[model samples]
Target: MKRKVDNSYGIIPFYIPSEKIVEKSKGCYLYDSEGKQYTDFESGVWCANLGHSNDRIVKAMEAGIRQSIHHGYKFRNHPSEFLSQELVRITGLEKGSSVFLSSGSEAVNLAISMARNITRREKILKIHNSYLSAYGYGQITPGNNHIENVHFNDMQSLDETNFGEIAALVLETGGASIDMVRFPDYAFIQELVELSVANGCLVVADEVTTGMGRMGKWFGFQYYDFLPDIVVTGKALGNGYPVSAVTVSAKISESFGKNPFRHLQSHQNDPMGGVIGLEVIRTIGDENLLNRCLDTGHYFKERLLFLNAKFKQEIREVRGRGLMIALELDNSVNGELVSDLLFERGFVIGYKANTLRFLPPLVIEITEIDKLITNIGEILELLRQ
Candidate 1:
């Protein structure tokens, strides 16, 4: 596994580029070009729920490719049709329909577009710190008149908001963007939904990172009481493959019938994307990964809590739901250094500012978690010394 060429020469550096060239990934481990094994605790950007190179998903993809890979928007594919039905059923949408796309950004933007079209309004509401998409109206930008920000758990902000011209309220329960992992207050979410609906504004759940058993459920919105008019899912939906879906409730779907909404993309509703998404859903159900995620997530959180207790001065708080856990370190501690040390010890996790994020594959075993915990404890101890 030797590097044959400089990989970063022609590529745009989106974030800080990693020096290591990963040659292979299997299950929960990655093999670098130098043949070094590193545990992938972040699930390859929080997408590989079933693990890297899952046999079932790969096989299904192969089968689908043999049938049909890409069909233009003029014609629909069988895999997309079946996937839409399954998505509707799983999301508990009443007579819902789905549209598949390549990335979370597109799905989210499309969902917002649908909301605006149905309500015939321009304004979209989003939580202050929640990250919905990479671009378009979903992405928060200064001077963006179409978007409005409401503070999470702040009743004053919600009450002050004039929902008169609002089209939809986009909600992201898993706050991976702001502070690694933060769940909103249950009461606030309930009240927010009620207010949005009462004001004729649709509710959109941005479950890009929180969907497909990431939060120990089919969707993050399930943790709350209300159902979203539109549900957007990505990340774990494709098991590392590029696929996303926007599922709309019967009401929203029916609105499109009377008031047409046209969306066209090159890879929209591709059969391969549909097959991969379907297989990911089916595999999670057949293998019972949701319950497994809950069990492993509990055990993992408990171990992290033990470390937190042991190093109370260094660790700040442990929070998150299911496998989407986060360890907030003391302000004095350098989270980037801790993450770098973990990488040196053959573990790959995510760090932003003072938070260490963990989104491991659901198939990860207890022993692997134990290894990570042991390493984390040792790292914290060393930092203290």
Candidate 2:
């Protein structure tokens, strides 16, 4: 007799998972237990930028595992040191310092903590529609006293705010969590940063989803004119590995030296995490994936726009940059149903309310994108009836 499988026996029901058991993954594709192949348009929760089980990243991780995964807080690792240097160099945080963590939420919280400690302020500010972190000061809530919200792309909101009491303005440029890939206005961000800085409030860029060439730039903050005081990176940073980083500017690092804010975690600077992160950065640079991401993203958006024009009654709008794209359905159309149909067709995407988000791997080919587009059009035509 064959044994019956119980996939969800002990798993917490935080979110419902798919029934298909993923057996293997490689370069923007997932294979099921039955050997069916599916394109991973969501990039495995927007983490696998270079794609799932990238050979280079896997080799780096294997090497790190052979040497050491963890050294605790007492001893230092060369991987962590080298990774920090690379992060500082890429972010243009001259003489800055970096610390690795296990998740985006932790990195975001650490950045907020640093800003509060450095500014000696009690409040954090964020865009009304932005999603910063899963917990801590970054998580916006109605009852949260320490966090305040300013409307995105609204100058009036900025004009009314008192930056004097704010510690940091946490900015997340693009993500599925915040109504799907909404980019902030250039002028609004510039003024917001200028006003916040003038009032002694630091700017913290939450690049957890928008970093690692997801936005066709090294970091989303680069899209704007100003440089941020602190940067929190995760998701694509380790290319599917659970590693996050908090990088502070030279000024913030200097403040830390004088003020001394102690923060310790078990995996704070694990060699494996450092090794994976460094490999991810190096691979993206060596492959010239940033420019490729730009070109591919433009092509994808154009195709999506063409679809929008074709199905005027189905697609409401197409938005986002780089690999982070969203296709919002019309009010009458059901996005979840559309997503399910696409999943059945061997393509996995993200759906929230009326938005269908696509965060494909940077290594995704134009042919793969065309396949997805064709599937979407066919699905839409079927749903129209």
Candidate 3:
């Protein structure tokens, strides 16, 4: 028999298909072509926070399509207006205005651009192991690197060094690693923010993955004490839609408004995208999803801890908060093998750097959580045998 092969070639092929192609999805479960259901822990690359085919999001998309879809970058519309207002209110950035974009990468670029234009500096500081975007200006430069990398744990005398040449200090709220989910050290983050203020460097936070209630908070920055000059958010912003936004504080916004800035995309302020964003936020608030995340996250971590305790030799550490968790298994356990075995057992998860990352939907049920835990336990036992 000739096996069917996918013609799509551009993707990184990080997780090659091990079973039937996914046909449809609803809530936290995905249905494949053969009608077999699998639990989704990755949330379609961490975007489907409200779950798959959410009624609210679907309805919003339908109605938004009827009303208006895209208004050129120059004109403003109701969906974008309401979305911006809601985003400001949800993010608790009272004096900040939102600019919609298509993806996290776009938002990151725009935020970096804003930071550079406002401070008139080229040197951007970033923490080590933080992911902004592959194509984002945060790390990309033509010749000499303009971005400075700082280690979160090894900031020995960074504060003493002069940051006069730095324009912005971009940061990812939580540092993700193969061994553990590393939330930033509070005192270290505070020092960085304080130094940024003292040195006149704009602080831009890239909340591409940690925002939209993923960290059991409205935004990841809320976990800390300071507010960033610019906040770049995406991934779960539209709950699976291709949407993102860069939020600028009133102070920096005014500075950019004074001058002519050249940045625009065809789908910059699409009404459908706005509607999706609005509905997703509304659903999260109305559904009390934040509290739910805290509750379910506690339970999920408990189960993971129990598993780690039982499989001490195979598991190295369990880290992360809320639904964003990771299982750092021992080196002997092939991460890809574990991923493939779990996938064959009707479970879907993320594997990177010998770690099994779990980013389940905020609406995931207790039963689904149990299914994942049980399958993992079975897989480990089989591996042991």
- Candidate 2 deviant stretches above 4 angstroms: 1-8
Candidate 1: which stretches are off by over 4 Å? 1-8
Q: How big is the RMSD of model 3? A: 2.8
Candidate 1, backbone clash total:
0
By summed lDDT, which 10 consecutive residues of candidate 1 come out lowest? 1-10
* Cα deviation of 266, candidate 2, in Å: 0.2
- Model with the higher lDDT, candidate 2 or 3: 2
lDDT of each: 0.90, 0.90, 0.83
Model 3 alpha-carbon drift over 4 Å, by segment: 1-19, 139-144, 160-162, 175-180
Clashing pairs in 2: none
Task: Answer with 1 or 3, whichever has the higher TM-score.
Answer: 1
| Model 1 agreement with the true structure over 1-385: per-residue lDDT tens digits | 1223443578655566468789999999999999999999999989999999999998998898799998786787888889999999999997999999999999999998988888899999988889978899877678668888888789999889998889999999987867579898999998888889999999999999999999789999999978899999998889999999999899888888898979989999999998999899999999999999999999999999999989999999999699999999999998888888999899999888789999999999999999999999998888888
After the best TM-score superposition of candidate 2, give how far the Cα of residue 288 lies from its true spot, in angstroms. Answer: 0.3
Count of backbone collisions within predicted model 2: 0
TM match of model 2 to true structure? 0.97
